[model samples]
Target: MPAGYSLHDFSFDLRQHMAPANVWVTSGWTSVVAAPGTVCGVGGCFAPPYAAPDSSLSVTLEVDGRELRDGVRAGIAGFGLGLLTSGGTWRPDRIERSGTFHQYDDGRLVSLGVHSRLTPVHGAGGYVLEITVENRADRDAEISIHPRLSAGQPGRLPLADWGWMAPRAGDLVAAASTSMTLRHDLLHSRVPAGGRTRFTLAVELGEAVEPGEAARPGATEPDPADRARQATDRWARRLATALDAFPRLETDIPGLAAYWHRSIASGLVCLWDNPGFVTTPFVATSGVDGGALCAYVWDTGGYAPHLLTLMLGETATDLLEAMLKADLTKHYAIAPDGTGLGVAYAYSGWSLVTLATAVASQRGLARGLVERLHDAVAALDARFPAVGELRDYGTQHNLLEMRGAGWEHVVASPNAERAAYLDALATLAEASGAVLPVDALRATAHRIRASIADELWDAEAKWFRSRYPDGHTELTYSVQAFDALRAGACTPQMAADLIARVRPGAFLGAYGVSSVSAEDERHYELGDTDWSGGGAYTGEAPQLALTLWERGEAELAWTVLSRLLWMGEHYPYFPQEHYSDRPAAPPVGRRANIIAGLAGAEAILLGLVGVRPRPDGGLVISPPPAPGNVALRGLRFRGRSIDVECTPHGFSVTVDGRRIAPEGGAVVVPAA
Candidate 1:
């Protein structure tokens, strides 16, 4: 371990030989490659953008006339350190390596510290290779410095002027479509005993134009080290601020604390701020530069509440606005061109209303913003068709139908979500002071609730069923029915029945609650990529867990939430979906997925801490009566910082460091 380094740091290590070590600049333009047989570039060296090329960037080092090419070990460190080893059979137990990824506030700059040390032997000495790659806002340049280094070309370089010069030679302009390869014999430097050297490689895509040029004015390029330090400090401040603003939960469960801390940090990183695109500044579904770069409406909405807790109201607002801007009222996915695509799923609109209400209720949205959202909600609600006498809306498929509906039958889950959305609309209307048909909305919500109890509830099966247009029903067990619990559509007995089915070997699995019953034959056959049959879509798990907690099933809710947190430990960050059987395996879809990350982080505050925001702008701190004593601190509400400490005796609260007596001996405070 090194200074400013901890195991909790999000990192990926290259355990095998010649494994690909890729690093992406924060600008999302350049990828620094250190893998064997690859060409390392700063700017357009790789693809135009997105990720590094398939070919590896090659580097050969020479020390004291001895060429160190084979059996050499190298690693690319980002946000943390990971050392790489040569593909040959060579093992040196005396060498220690570490590194850290640093991101600057400019959104176009990032750096990493690649450090190594050789243990003292009878005649052994110290050696250091300091490698730093910085994306310059100025002209394009690729600078690589090693101890008398000779570079080899393992693959064909794209047409670009190429040449070998002194390690400290000045910048040279190259012609387009020019290519050159430097031999290892062109090195003449060496490292003396107890000596250290710094290597710098920079590649700038001078041709890359700044998107929305007006958005970035007077951008100044700083030294890599200074930028790195500034990035480190900024991240530190962010984490500290998050801890101070959100409630903290410490439990006796193993690995829970570390997961809590990492989720908060990782959630912030998922926010992308690139301009020129509709999804710019929107939260990405995954950290991957490839297919997972786009944002999903359902996923963004799932994570918005947790973002509010962290005082990231702007990010939540941006995401919702992006979706509406793409016309989510009629589309399932928002295209990069700001156009909506695919038929609007029922859950997507429901998510919009839900997230809108949360943001407005938390005062995260301005009155004008709320007005826009109210209009979007009204538009989305108008798209739903009246399918039955109940006037309850339906979807072609539920959230589980990621690809498409296997059966075009009316589903209970979407109707339940619609009920919740109607409630949210009423709340948002009241909060935003916007003119809305509140009485009609409430009456419609009541009809939907009653219809859920009469038409969807399977009294004999003791669960909700997906009814078809022909009056037939699919009696398969689905965790989605729990949405009714959150929508206030379930009866006391129905809620008890749903709670009982959430146990392990049924709907619950090792990782989290399964989408379908584990005992179902179709559970194992669901499509691996999206929500299909039985696997747990990490984004939806927490909603059910939160509902369970609110419905007085705190123990069962904790069981689901803790399992999801535990599973999140395996990924560098939280992922989109995890298979029920392969709980510890890497996610089947995107890595560093934001939806699940946001949802999981929110579970800590909404489920464990019980920090629910009221429509009247007041705060409520009513943690469940679980066995463990809980302490929630730094909850921001009505411009005041609140803290709550719970014990067997009762809970004590402090607002802005002043002790406040609870109303009726419970932690309840009026709106500031």
Candidate 2:
């Protein structure tokens, strides 16, 4: 592990947080959450009030027998968190925490100054707790620590999950223990005046099972301590690799580096590799929030680079190739059986463009993939032979409720996104040998851009208002305008002009950029649906930051990133969207999708360490000014692995050990 990107660097403490709150970690196939007690499942965790004795599904911690000194509850089914002994019944008088690890003072646990500590470890399919107790009195003392589990019932699975897919047979979950120095699940040791004892307790959530078989452990089971060490190291490396795998910001900015690491790490936990789904590695949330129960284009844009990098060979190529087959304009989400699941939003093509950008960033416009992209674009164009420009079905279906502009007008989002798609289509045709009418595609895209930039730019309000069929601009400041910027809908001066109006009492909120500007109270609201107003859709704010960074407003971009970083710090995993004035989701119906929250990582990846893959088969390296010495290493672009090293001294790039020359104000690494 390098100095900054070590295992402990990602550690955080939730002990003082409200009980039952969780911070989840995953192995892609398996997942677990840290709550009052270790919970293995989607969202079936609660504080105290445990189950009856020997319950089929529960996490238990038993110490001593009955009351210790006076009357501290112990050895009881569904215990109340305490231990009893001779001198004085022990309780947690004072507890301290450092990065998920916990410590307790002496004399509060038992007669002989019983001091204790807890260290948490995450395994491939489970989480482990290593509990240690020490005695400091003159005489010897006896201690017993029993970590018990009773999982898997007759029909019901112990580990509960938010049903992302239709229920299948053999939803089995298991539990394992490595009681190295214990008898019958009990760890007993006589602690001398200055002696100590330790043991490990672990629980696991397995992968999807076959009808008649049990679930399988995700990885090879190692000894408890080795498992802990190895898991920690792997996670550290994964986080560090994400820095290089995607784009990483090398800065000492307070909260920036840690925020970036966690932003990328959130993607790891959000991924659930259930074999039953249409896609093996699903982008659905692991019962957190955001209701992302299936693979989504919106999510693929944010986390795909890290996953794509891990699958650097055929698997990577195959996955990116599949994006062309995805019906981005069809459904908001698809089911496990490959059928549409959610709304067929009008601007759902935004999802396609989002994923398209991700694909471009990872693989560039490589020849073979460009051929596939050409076919996909041709088929997409085939749908609009008579519809003139284009318009998807469903009104006000961009993200959620849109009362402004009747939610059914000639909007800017889908137009901007379509222009992006068509623009990419033309560029892809030019880059590869694929034959297509590039001139027509470019002309159509330009016409759309011209229409938006000409009619939609509200000179009076300094915002791109949604336009209606009546040729009038809608009154409101929407975050979707930011989307237009992402799709190259705004000229440089126009982009600056639009961004200049984003401030405290307008589009910018205390948390991040609001879905609807502050003063637009008629349309702005703290509702459940995404961007359903008055709040920051956790994902869009990152896009805003990335857009700002692209426009050379690094400071403003950092402003937005830092505001959302506060959410990541407060909530271990970022939620879908939150209110501007508070750290909470909308008041109405809500769901969890760490995938949306994970977009924060994309801002870090593409913004600070900006490495964009252009549609013309070239990779662009144009990062924001670094306040310190840092580097983005091992970036796999256009089928070639490259490194971007930057410091206060000078920034440079190397492709396969050959230093490359900077061209046109940025380094353009040509396809190998």
Candidate 3:
């Protein structure tokens, strides 16, 4: 079998690779695990309440009469096998015992390369592992490949017992607990003197109703090579579709272009569509290795808007629907066990609005879904006290309570977000032609907005401050104010003041925008990994950048975006947050944060590309007036795909392959 190409650079330095130790490839229901030293397995095989240990595959490789039980592990251990990259070399003999692992450059190598992929088939899915090896010495190399699954350990019951799998020819059958089966195929060939050879191991995991029922619907029994080709084609189409939706950056900077492509691909990987589980198709904030296997309402909400930019409307819908179906009263995070919702911060309203925006943009939300959403929002609204003369209820700090701001009692950020949610509900009701309390929602939103401008805005501080429940106001510069600004609660002058305060020495940091002004003594303080005192949260960076972009601070917006992307160069995964200080601490959470990826994607599509979806099934696009060339193609809006090209001279828009006159032909940057 020929080696399959990698969608992204899955190859990392050997030392850092074991930190997570597992590489996950998922086609919704089926999750394939590819670990460096150990064999691969299927994750989440058993249903909810039963923690099923993955069915592990162990491998043995024979080269030149030498039997290798674990080629990768042996190679890292410096047993005649060596790992080489362009910049650094790693051998067992020269292993360093101190500090960080030797960082290897990302490029080609003559020795070996391991690539893994998750591909969907008609009824089942295939996890393909392609290993390519080249003989640099002058000798013919004979290779033998062995792949088998060992019975899981006893005593752990449902999760530990690997069940019972009877191997027949090329297939493995499990009949004990759950009706599951997998077909495995190994393909390999000999390598001539100084020649290269590719080995492929394909495993097909699918559901079986009875003892010997035919393969599940859409499952196919194909050759390992054919399976790999199909999976490769599917992933290519997905990446192409996603890339067409945003501006293709033309830059001389290294890794910038790869970042754009990887960002979209990584975001899609984190979105799971498992039909086997209760929440069959929900987006996991972090993939399996990220340690966050469930969905958080706030994180999913943040992910929805960005997911829309990738033309993943169906996926975004599934996630929002799952959230609505879960216990809305305690809607905080969805447990991995699929049992009940976990309550933390009372910020479901914010997530609801994001879901509404994504649904409204699709222009095809079912009336039933809209009505259900309306009821949920109404229930959420009832939890808040009425919008009285002072609108104190609207100013409650319920939104940022999880971020260590609960002591503030009342805050403008949640009020602004509440106002935004009400506006979204009204818009969604009108768009779906549903008989919702649009008038009442609009009135409440208006009251909340009025209160934010009047009660939260401190004239002397020139910032939106929190008004204590005791009738006292606390003046603290916070990045949370950007949320209110995004909701349009601030006037023109007020917005300007906030923007000026976010300049480089204040809230802006090298990694991203800080949660609090640098001048604040508590800016560098850390609290429970939340955005309390201060931290550069990747999820919030794009929000602030987008706000600045909308306010015509194009240059500043791009600066903020550049900083966020800069972190991607250093961190292998999309970090959740970082310290505000220079040379910030290592990123928090797993390498992949769905919220951050989505937000970064949105910053490119909505902020820099200046494309906004209108409730009336139209698009409002206004690309920033920056001195760079960008061509945005394949942008889907309200069932119509549009292409946009922007240059220093002007810009052009084409709707569904036909050119249409834009409201504004070209954006001219004002002289500083």
Candidate 4:
């Protein structure tokens, strides 16, 4: 009865408000149909794949005063039935051979009878329905109905379009995203003697339609595109369900909001699947479910804090403590003099910086924890004293380890900058106005920054290079270079030069920057075994663009952001990783993918106008400086309802009807 309410939410056919149109197919497969019960003994139904047996079934329904639009079709794909994209072929797993439909209305009340079942593979949700017939006669009853879900655009490919697709031969993506919706109808069959027929279809329990609300009219058919978009709304409900699976986080509500808000803030950095993992916190794009089992992680130390710091401040402290306990024993088996070890192990140390900083921020220097953190920082400085790129740590347990090994360390390392960035942990040491060992960490960070500028910066190459034991630099521009810029350790010219070098090749692909520079031959290696291994290795392009923008490269950053989104629109769904070479690889799974994580988080939390808690107990409404025509309307922030209009002229914020002072340079309001 309300906007955005669905049968899954209110047990009613909210489709009643949709506009009338043609049959449609979403992404492909899922179908909806509409029909009148007056003569055809038919009503309406939403159908999905059935379970147990190999056939599809309609979840039956009956409505009163409901305009049953024609039948429609749709599809669902990508990570846990979320991340839906329009256009695809949906072949019937199987069709129901026999079924029944009936409708009866007693003034204000209505009843509908139907039976059907269908099954879909890899589909978790299932559908169910049962009805009894009293008549002893059988007849061929033709249900007058239209397939609202199978409709196409004014000029679009038909449902059978995929029949012509070449399997992975080339891009199987549609020419463009389709815009459509779905409507469904009742299924009919025979009347048997005192017998009841039971039917089942795959469906989420939350989306089941209520018996009484089934026939209430006003359901209209939309194109397939509209329907696919509708399916994505199901993700939040699914997220709620998935949350039920996890034990309630042991943290206060305010703390919990802070934690989620931190994650939400990180999401603003990029709109790709980099469910931030490793040391850097949420990568704005590359991260997933916290803890060790995250997807494609690198530098978890830098990635983890981005997720924990803003919220659950105490919990963040606990997380750091936990990592110290778990990782120290496994990843940091280094000797005191930092000698005789075959390789370098830094992920634990990198992450420890985030942990120590988080703890010091909350508890201050008086807590003995600061000493332990200082000790850890001291160890890191002692271990990788030279400040070159780090190597992959090693393999431990089931997941790939990040213990920084031998000469292998020079390749694909996230060292130096990560360590320097993590050294910001020292700032928390000043919490009590007491001098801390923080200065030691700051000095170490400064040393690494200076070393990078002196040795790693290749003036001829115009970017930072990976220094190797062979005394040759890997002449390539790296996002790791951007990390140094973000650390505020790089000089302005260095940052500008880094941006200049990144504009060429895969680093500036159709999406955003690639983790590996395109000019480097080793960037696209495919293998069953290697440190980088296979699967999704490249970072989402939007993330690199965001880093550039954050570093003040606005125009070039916008160019990359637009291209990455454009590439996203062409995929099966917003992939966790896109092929730097092929923009249309039927996106990989969504676990720990930063792109989806960042995009979804940004759309709701930041693009909608973000709220961050300031140390002084107020909120900061810093809207993202996203390129293109970015706007935030109906944004709700602390102390007032507000909206932000951003342009090249900078940003302006309005609260209620009054323009507030952004004069503070950042929008700060007292904490709620």
Top TM-score model:
3
How big is the positional error of residue 158 in model 2, measured in Å on the Cα after superposition? 16
Q: Candidate 4 lDDT (Cα, whole model)?
A: 0.34
Local distance difference test, per candidate? 0.50, 0.51, 0.54, 0.34
Which is superior by TM-score, 2 or 4? 2
Better of 1 and 3 by lDDT: 3
Global CA lDDT computed for model 2 = 0.51
TM-scores for every predicted model: 0.74, 0.74, 0.75, 0.51
- CA shift of 334, model 2, Å: 4.0
- Candidate 4 — which residues are off by over 4 angstroms? 1-198, 201-324, 328-413, 432-436, 470-473, 504-506, 521-540, 567-574, 586-596, 599-629, 633-643, 654-658, 664-672
Q: Write the per-residue lDDT of candidate 3 for residues 1-672, one digit (tens) a residue.
A: 112223443222334422333334444333444444332222322222122234555555556555544433334533233222222111111111111112122332223332223343322433555545555545566766666654342111221111112111122234343323344544455777668666665554433433232244456646765765665565555545534444344444455554555455446565544344434345566643423456667776754364543445445566567677766665566654343445434567677667667666654566678788878766765665544523343322345543433325456776787788778878877878877788998897888888878877887778877666666666767787887788778888888888888776678777667777766564335563346544555578777888888888888888877776554444344545665545343433333344455676666677777777665555677887654776666655545656777666667777767776665554222111
lDDT (tens digit, per residue) of candidate 2 on 1-672: 123344444454453222233333444333333332332112221100110111222222323443222123344422243432211110011111211111232433333323222222332234444545556545566666544354322122322232343222244222233111111234677677678676555544333344432333443445665655555565555445433444434665666665666565555555443454455444454333213445554455433343333433223444444454566444455543344545444444445544544455455546666666556544544433222354432356544466544334566666777788777666666665557688887898888788778866776677776555545556666777777787888887778777876788877778777777767766776653356466766778887888888888877887777777665455545555677665566543444335666667666656766776665546788776754555666555555767776654556887877888777658887655
* Prediction-by-prediction clash tally: 20, 12, 9, 111
- On residues 524-586, what C-alpha lDDT tens digit does candidate 1 reach at each position? 345643345456666667777788777877778888777766553444445556665456433
Compare the candidates by lDDT and give the number of the best one.
3
CA shift at 237, candidate 4, in angstroms? 7.3
lDDT of 2 at 567: 59
Candidate 1: list runs displaced more than 4 Å: 1-56, 65-189, 210-244, 247-252, 277-280, 308-311, 335-337, 364-372, 389-399, 402-408, 470-472, 522-530, 586-592, 626-629, 647-650
lDDT of 4 by residue, 548-582 (tens): 55555656755654554433222211334444444
Model 3: colliding residue pairs: 78-92, 122-218, 122-219, 123-217, 123-218, 123-219, 124-219, 244-633, 573-591
